[model samples]
Target: MTRLLNEEIIKKLVTMHDANRIIDQTFQGFGNKTVINPSKVSLDLGETGGYPFHEGFVNAMPAYIGDMDLAGIKWVSGIAGERREAGLPYISAMILLLDPRMGEFISVMEGTYISNLRTGAQTANSLKYLGFKDKVSIGMYGAGEQARFQLEAIADLYEITELRVWNHRRETAEIYANEMKQYVSGETIICNPEEGEKAAQAEILITVTNAQEPILLREWIKPGTVVFPMGSFQEVDDDLILSVDKIIVDHPDQALNRGALKKLHKEGRVTEENIFTTLGQLAIGAVEMPNFQEEIIMCIPIGTGAMDVSIAGHVYKRALEQGLGENYSFINYN
Candidate 1:
């Protein structure tokens, strides 16, 4: 029998806290050599004109965790400009879990929420391990769905003193600020062009935009600041990338291929030598945090299959225990 869980059921079964723990455990498994994650496979569709000339892509991510005895693959789709034109999310994904022992399909669940929560948890975990201990202000470069999840997860873990937000569209920033006021007790500032520096000055800065060019500059960042560029495209310049005190990534290979540093990687401005350590190493105590005089640290996470499968496995168990999903047979026993 296969359990089929929808987004609502997955949401009911999993919380931000659960996602955080699951991601931590997944990283621990990676450190302990108990998780197998392959390079993600993606198929790009060039100007398909499906939604009036929009580009899109389909990606497949597969992983197995020995400790949890779980295996799964996430199939994800992304269509550019869908949100603005059609009011649809930019990305949609689903996960198929298989029994690790017999290779039998066990369950299927929505992966969009899992991706959001796990991505947020990854940042929260990075902040917990690598950020300043004192309460600090947070700055968001993009006010979108991913930014909302990042704020929610971070709020659950840290005591935020203030929030500063800027977006390409002021209306989006205003909407995000209004909605996030309930979560942030401190003041929320909607930044203007002149006041954009305020967001960059925050003790913790997070960039979640799908920009092709850099939006954050090295001059704007301050000492003792931690930055997270969480988008798939470039959001920070090479100067900022080269000037950071240390660079930490979820996975070296994936990070090098995408996010803020991809251009730098291609230009040979940054390499493996520039990376201080991976999040897994920090999670499992494989490497010590650098004791550097420079106070700026940047962490980048390109969402991984391990994170997806780990969260999926956790949600699957909880859904079964709580009787939240419908069960259907995938194979016939004759």
Candidate 2:
């Protein structure tokens, strides 16, 4: 039998806290070599040729967690513009869990929520392993749905007293502010129109933008700030990358191939020597946490399928235990 779970049902099955813990454990498994995340296969479609002409892409991400004996694949699709005008999510996905021993499908679930939620949970776990707590001010670039999840997940573990947001469009920033008022005080949510200076001058700076070039400069980063450039391409400049006290990433291969430092990696200016550690190492205590209070620590979380699959496995089990999802028999050949 295979369990079928939709986004709404999956949401009920896994909370942010659950996702955070699962992601932490998964990272630990990654560090200990009990987890495997293969490189994703991507199919890129040229521009849409519409108003925004956002590029479209689909990715197939597969993973296996040996300790738990869970294996899965996620098929996800996204576009640059996300069809926002038509009221659709930027990313939509589906996750299929398989019994590793038999390679048989055990469950299939909606993956968009899981995808957005787990990425945020991973970032929060990174902060936890890095030792951040209490009354943190957050500055964010790119006020979008993913940004909301980041703040939401972090607020579960920390006290967010202030939130400063910057977006290319002012209306979206205001919308984000209104949407995030539950976690951050309405009075403290400042929407910045300038070139991301006010947003960058916080204790925890995050960039979720889709910018191909750098928007955050080295000068804006304070001595004690923790930076997370969570976008696909470069959001922070070379100076910031070179000056950070410690550089941590989710995976070396993914980080070198994409994300903020990809350009530097290609230029032979950055390599494993430049990265201090990975989030997995930090989670497993293989690497010591840096002095986040006195140093500029930047964590580049390019995200991984291992985290998603692990969370999916957890959610599937929980749903089964609670009888939350619909069950259907599979491979019924007479």
Q: Quick one: best TM-score, which candidate?
A: 1
Q: Mind giving the per-residue lDDT tens digits that candidate 1 earns over 85-164?
A: 88788899999999988888999888999999999988887776673464668999999999999988888787778999
TM-scores for every candidate against the unseen true structure: 0.93, 0.91
lDDT of 2 by residue, 160-214 (tens): 8788888989889988988888998434556556667778878888999878778
Superposed Cα deviation of residue 219, candidate 2 (Å): 1.9
Best by lDDT: 2
Tell me the deviation in Å of residue 4 in model 1.
0.7
State model 1's lDDT.
0.84
Candidate 1 has a TM-score of 0.93
> Which ten contiguous residues of candidate 1 have the minimum total lDDT?
45-54
